[model samples]
Target: MNTSKQRPVRVAIIGLGWWGQKMVSILKSCGTELEIVCAVEPNPAAGDFCANNGLTLAASYDAALARADVDAVILATPHSLHPEQIDRGAAARKHIFCEKPLALTKADAERAVRLCREAGLVLGMGHERRFEPPIVDILQKASGGHLGRILQIEANFSHDKFMTLNKSNWRLDPQEAPVAGMTATGIHLTDLSVKLLGAAYDVRVSCETLASDFRQGDTFSAHVRFKGGGTAYVSATLVTPFVSRFAVFGTKGWIDVRDKAHVEAPAGWIITRASVGSLIEISEVGPAEPVRENLVAFARAVRDGRPYEISGEDLVNNIALLEAIIRSAASGEVVAVG
Candidate 1:
């Protein structure tokens, strides 16, 4: 690892929406290795936020990229804009940390990964659940064979956070957020499932509007078959109360985790494990700053030459799985993942 940490990595944060503001708060709280040089938001309302936070407001993304002081950019923009913005950022020779669901399609995701790779810039992802304490422990146990031959996985990440958004919101637009809650909540579950179970071979999904006014849909459930012979069932609902749970079953035993609150709130986590012949055990994991940890890791990759935890393969595969889910939901048939 490169030990030259003489200066903090300066980054320009793009977008100042709810998640964007949350990221700004997280960085302000614990981002010692990172410096928020500027905030790029076209929305005039965000000007007050920048003023109060003492951050310079860039007139546009182009303006931010033109600055020599900005070493990286944190993209918290709309889903459809990711691919184009990534292309532009790479051309500007700026490292990028994009939010979830890198792109709406596999081809776009592949191009984004390729551009960042060719530019020799770090590509960071916003799947901060991997940095959560209980999640990290669960992955370690599964990888260490403590779970013994994984058979199946089940996960649900649901919330009503977007139910209040206007029907015209980009998040509710079919072009930007197809297949309902998949982009907002279910994608995180798929990312975790891919890590635990391996590459998904195919998927069958169902989506329905249910209670939300959004035209695309509000609820979705998917069944994924992994190439490694394991299967997973994942679901998310946009009209439900906060519910984040994950479970893995193996030939030897099973493990379950329940988060007391959302990743942003960080209440705590309850984990339970049971072996075939042993008693079930339950434990509690205290609240942690996973979002901050993820950004810090990204800054380290940019400044200290450390490898970011999320890999290029993981980024592309997750997007491929998402594409399959969207297709399956649309056709009401099983869709194969690349």
Candidate 2:
């Protein structure tokens, strides 16, 4: 939370696509702590959206970066553009909050982190699942040794939301999206795995086009081995009805969480737990606006020099695992993560 003494973080949103527009709506609902001063979208049709939202529509990303009033920039741009945009933001001396799958490659992710660190700028991520109440509870239990000797995790995040997208959309492009549903959905699972089980040592993945026209494939399943002696199975399918689940297994106890709706439209979560000498327990966690929580934390970091939840090392490690997932899917062999 930000103190009233601190001024709002004026931001220029770098895209006006579905997720970008969604960010605008979330920030508006977040009150005056985070202000959208401008927006950069190539599509001229977004002019009306900017006008209605009381935002200045910049002609280009460079124009937005050059704005003196813009204290930070939130990137909802394509995956390939993240590294360069982060570099530019650091050069402009503005704080940055980038959408997930920060970069498609490990080197680019590392470079983005380095540039931001060198410039003493806050680099925030779009992994909102970390802020979810249920996930936070799980993390606390695991770290407190209540779960005891973590063994494995299984997670799946799938939805048919992208099925209506045009075939030529960048999200469906092989060069842009790469492996199946990994970029759009599976990456979030992997990020959660890293947060719970530390870095991955290797991964084996299979990507197949089951029902969608996406050239890269509509589904992918990844088997990851963690360096800290645990395993994780993370998967996603673009053609499936909405499904989000995560289970953590440990020596003492295990927990299973099932979401009734997407994070953007949270309904509730069913959590089941079991322990060595106790009866299985089931509880329900109410809905939460994690996306707004994540963005507000980023704003607070920029305004008060507070630390963001995801560390730079964690950011790079997740991208490293993502790179391995892509390679394993391509070669039909297990790939090692560095």
Worst 10 residues of 1 by lDDT: 1-10
After superposition, candidate 1 runs with Cα above 4 Å error: 1-4
Query: How does model 1 score by TM-score?
Result: 0.97
In Å, residue 187's CA in model 2 sits off its true spot by 0.6
lDDT of 2 by residue, 84-192 (tens): 9998899989899999989998999999999989888889999998888888888899999999999999999999998999887888888889888899988888998
Instruction: At residue 47, give the lDDT of candidate 2.
Output: 96
Tens-place lDDT digits, model 1, residues 130-245: 99988888789888998899999999999988878876778888888888889998899999988887789999999998886777788899999999899999999889999999
**lDDT for each of the candidates?**
0.90, 0.90
Would you list the clashing residue pairs of candidate 1? none
Estimated TM-score for each candidate = 0.97, 0.97
* lDDT for predicted candidate 1 compared with the true structure: 0.90
